[model samples]
Target: MLEEELVELRFRLGDGSDMGPIRYSSALTIAMLKERIVSEWPKDTKITPKGSTDLKLISSGKILENSQTIAQCRTPFSDLPGGLGSGGAGGGVITMHVVVQPSLTKTKTEKKVDDMPKKVTVCSCTIS
Candidate 1:
């Protein structure tokens, strides 16, 4: 397998940020890409995904598998935008949509109650 066949990939996050125009070999796996995304994720984001399991990479309306390669995911030049490395050799940037689905450790009710102040007040009244 020739590693020279490089393809640029861009990951679009939920925050409307493009994570990469990073070059990857056609042989790179989707699982590997997820790992890269997790590592490159912005620290400033409030909600962080626990691991690669929390991520989903979609291309051409299809959710990519861990075993799948960049070559399998490559898109045609006409479909890519200029910023996604549409100029050079191999097919244009294989833009992938990233969906972060972090597992919820607590329920909605738990979150709501946790935010409430735990204070008690007593009122005494005299009636005639």
Candidate 2:
């Protein structure tokens, strides 16, 4: 594929910071993109994704599915301001929002609570 045909993408975190202005093939799948994101994730961030499953890629106000390709997720140039009649490497770079949602698993402290002994109450009744 020609270099001009490649899609340029930038990943934006919740903090409004950017990851890359990297070029990828239009045929690249969202799942593949997630893998790349997990590997290239910034180490400085307090919250990091454990795996690709923890990532959600949102583009153009829509959540991109794992099966979707770069071309399918790309926003039309007309929809962007100052993006008319542009294509290829020099064209506007699409920005995708990356959300890291960790799995809801019980922590060690929670497990310890379950292991604790239950309180016992003894009631005594006296009848005359």
- Identify the candidate with maximal lDDT: 2
Residues 38-97, model 2: lDDT tens digits: 999999988899899888998878899999988776645556665522556456678889
TM-score between candidate 1 and the true structure: 0.66
lDDT of 1 by residue, 1-128 (tens): 83366777788888888877888777789999899889989898866777998899998789989998877666434455663334356455567899998646444566889999999898999999
- Extract clashing residue pairs from model 2: none
Total backbone clashes of candidate 2, pairs 3 or more residues apart or in separate chains: 0
Model 2 weakest 10-residue run by lDDT: 81-90
> Model 1, residue 46: displacement in angstroms?
2.7
Which lDDT values do the candidates have, in the order given? 0.77, 0.81
Candidate 2 residue 100 Cα shift, in angstroms, is 0.3
